[model samples]
Target: MTRDDLIAMLREQTPACGPARNALIAGADFVVWDGLVPANRHAGVFRTRMRRSLKRGRTVDGLANSVDILRRAGEEPLRTGSIDAVDRSFWFMIFLNSTATAVVACFGGRRPITMESAGL
Candidate 1:
């Protein structure tokens, strides 16, 4: 898929809360990472590094370090012209918290629908 397509998929999958709550969802150029690394190929290594760093909490420095580790893997699975295990895993790491939000935005409105209002 194209970059725009990837962004669209992410936007659709990301829930309207946490970091994406009020921010415009757009693809930032992660020159050091993004398609430069095959996340799936080095999932174990990356996960280990990420887990270690995140143990200090989700600070900017920690996330940056994690991204750096992924970057070193270089493009392969990500550059294959289709979404693969690497892409999915990397996306999951980046968007995990936002996925926690189950609240969908109100139809044609900015307000987020409450579970009570939705009668769920």
Candidate 2:
């Protein structure tokens, strides 16, 4: 899919809430980790990274969960390589938490595309 397509997909899947309750990744050069490498996930999305270490934020984990959903849906799998982490050993991932279920997507590099999805 194209960058815009991916963004749309994420946005559609994200949930909307208050300021910090929104499902969006804030940064520049946002990309999704499909595996060991950083592949171009979607364009027009935020893409930011940590120069010193990765931050443990809700958005980061959310993005990773989205990736996992894609994989489980028979789509291509995404993963965080050594570069998308603070230690270059463990893979960074995102997840979605709800009252009933939780899912682990994949790790992403840089910033994530700000998306507000409500499973639309």
Candidate number of the best lDDT: 1
Sliding window of 10 residues with minimal summed lDDT for model 2 = 14-23
Tell me the number of clashing residue pairs for each predicted model: 4, 23
RMSD to true structure for each model, in Å: 15.0, 14.5
Q: Please provide TM-scores, in order, for all candidate models, with all chains considered together.
A: 0.29, 0.24
Write down the RMSD of candidate 2 (Cα, Å): 14.5
Model 2 C-alpha lDDT per residue in residues 32-57, reported as the tens digit of each score: 43433222341112233321224544
Badly placed stretches (over 4 Å) of model 2 are: 16-27, 36-120
lDDT of prediction 1: 0.32
> lDDT of each prediction vs. the true structure?
0.32, 0.31
lDDT of 2 at 8: 38
